[model samples]
Target: MTNQIYPCLWFDGQAQAAAKFYCSIFKNSKITADNQMVVTFELNGKKFMGLNGGPHFKFNEAVSFVVDCDTQEEIDNYWSKLTADGGSEGTCGWLKDKFGVSWQIVPTVLPKLLSNPDKAQNVMQAYMKMKKFDIRELENA
Candidate 1:
């Protein structure tokens, strides 16, 4: 037997809206099921459930979804879409979606760049000043 684990996001009566919004952003994503209380969706083939769990709890930076992008365009796309509407940007490529869910849009090469002790500090410094990750700048760093 195998176990499949997935994340369930709590929403304030906006499960359906949030699910639709997310589906619109990622390619090959869709809402699998929806109801007054819950909405199940798949983003890029990963399953997730959103519950209209009320205002008892809210999303914070303690937990965040990380999107590792291969290119500057990919990072820009996610950063722009996720920060649209009522969403706000945070330091170091972190941003809160309109639903207040925190997400990190980062370049896939970030780990590789940071792995080198010689260039790690420079790369970190460069990214520290960036809201959206710039792949070229990191490569240059």
Candidate 2:
């Protein structure tokens, strides 16, 4: 048997709506199924299932979807859109969308920059000060 792992998002009642919103944001994404119990979707080729499980559970920062972008434009684009409407921004590129799902919009180079021993502290300092990530600033740090 082939084993596969996919994230299942728990939603109070907006599973389909949240899935649709995610699909609209990422490339190569789509809604594969929708029904009273669940909504299945894909984002950037990753499969996700959203369950309309009721008010028993809610989303928090413990788990978040991270979006890694190659350019500042991509980062900005995603950050702006995700934080738009009723979404609120958090420090270090974290945010919660209108549906209360957490996300991190980060540049692809962030990890590499932070991995450098000489620059790690500076990079971290710069990163901790911003709501959205800026690749150039991190690089400069």
Predicted model with the maximum lDDT: 1
Q: What is the lDDT of candidate 1?
A: 0.94
For each candidate in the order shown, give its overall lDDT on alpha carbons.
0.94, 0.90
Give residue 92's error in model 1 in angstroms: 0.8
- Residue-pair clashes per candidate: 0, 0
| Model 2 regions more than 4 Å off | none
Question: Cα deviation of 130 in candidate 2 (Å)?
Answer: 1.1
Candidate 1 global Cα RMSD: 1.2
Report how far off residue 45 is in candidate 2 (Å).
Answer: 1.1
Colliding residue pairs in candidate 1: none
What would the per-residue lDDT of candidate 1 be over residues 65-110, giving only the tens digit for each residue? 9998998889989999999999999989999999999999988899
lDDT (Cα, tens digit) per residue for candidate 2, span 1-141? 268799999898899988988889889999999998899998998899999899998889999989888999998889888887899999998999998889998898987998999999999999989988888889999
Candidate 1: stretches off by over 4 Å: none
